[model samples]
Target: MPRKFKVTVNNVDYDVDVLEIGAGSPQAMPSYTPIAAQIAPISSVPAAAMVAAAPSAKTGPAGAGDQCAQMGGVVVNIPVKQGHSVNEGDVVVELEAMKMKVPVIADRSGQVARILVAVGDGVENGQALLTIA
Candidate 1:
């Protein structure tokens, strides 16, 4: 049997056709997505968002408001605070996910803005771990 599925890529939707050994008509054709593009990570951070901003918009950087959260355990320690500066790979969330402590690193270098979770609080996957400004 053949199946049809819809996929969204780069803000564009696509209707794809499949052939199950003997499916589809001879006139069927595969379409290429014009807007969808492949992304490669060559470095720890992308080069575009790191560029300096104009004097008006106060967005210090893209990673400035990013955070790392605990996976499955309680938030044990929080070494950094609001206004504190950090570099990439810095330990931001010290959590015990599976009978072991894990260190969630800072996704990028920036100043801390907000601490969303608290100590001794149990956290789930993708929870707000920290905030950078």
Candidate 2:
């Protein structure tokens, strides 16, 4: 047997049907199907609207020597400050994701021209962390 109930989520009301198991013999059990699969497809919906917009590429403020984050995480430490000298492969920023520390390395050897992110800041992939001149 299915019980109908009204549920509210984010101020939106939804009617749901829930079936209780073990109320009858195993042979009387009904096959389960997801609600989404049962809904009819809407051909009127535009394909572009169904797809999400991609994030835009970011560049350093100086327009060169930008060191971007490879993954999304919280900044745990900044090893280099603005005007500090750095070499290729040097760790410029450290991020913590999934309880693991990840180091952001410099791709070019130059002085740190700017630090775009600070310690305790959250960063996304491709976001500029610092720039080297």
Candidate 3:
């Protein structure tokens, strides 16, 4: 018996076939089939919309945005807010991902100009968390 699975990696789709054999004869050539593309993360937040003159666009450094989380997660808390002073390594925002709480820290000492994410809001990688200026 054989099973076929379609997998996607880095937006590239690939089809794979797996065969099971017992104490029988040898195997021959395997088969492959390509499938359609899977859902993309880009659809969550369009790059064009991020670059536009939106409220979230003013979140980080140089009026661009704050240092975003390296991974996507739900914002659990925002310890820092506008007009609040923070030092490097200070816990700014906490994110819950994979059932673990991840703390987002400040990289430099500065006054928080804006807090981009609110508690319970879903955030994406490279998305603004807060602005320090």
Local accuracy of candidate 1 as per-residue lDDT tens digits, 41-131: 5475556755643223222332436674535578888989878999988887799866789888987898988887788988766666778
> For residue 12, what is the lDDT in candidate 1?
100
Poorly placed runs, candidate 2 (over 4 Å) = 1-24, 27-31, 34-47, 50-52, 56-62
Clashing pairs in 2: none
Decoy 2 TM-score against native: 0.63
As a TM-score, model 1 comes out at 0.49
What is the C-alpha lDDT profile of model 3 across 31-93, one tens digit per residue? 445443444566687888767844442233334436577678899988776898888889989
Number of the top lDDT candidate: 2
Model 2, residue 21: displacement in angstroms? Answer: 6.6
Give me the displacement of residue 44 in model 1, in angstroms: 42
**Candidate 3 lDDT (Cα, 0 to 1):** 0.76
Worst 10 residues of 3 by lDDT: 56-65
Q: Estimate, for each residue in 28-62, the C-alpha lDDT of model 2 and write its tens digit.
A: 66689999988768786677866655555455343
Q: How well does candidate 2 score on lDDT at residue 131?
A: 84
Ranking by lDDT: 2, 3, 1
Clashing pairs in 3: 60-65, 60-66
Error of 1 at 62 (Å): 12
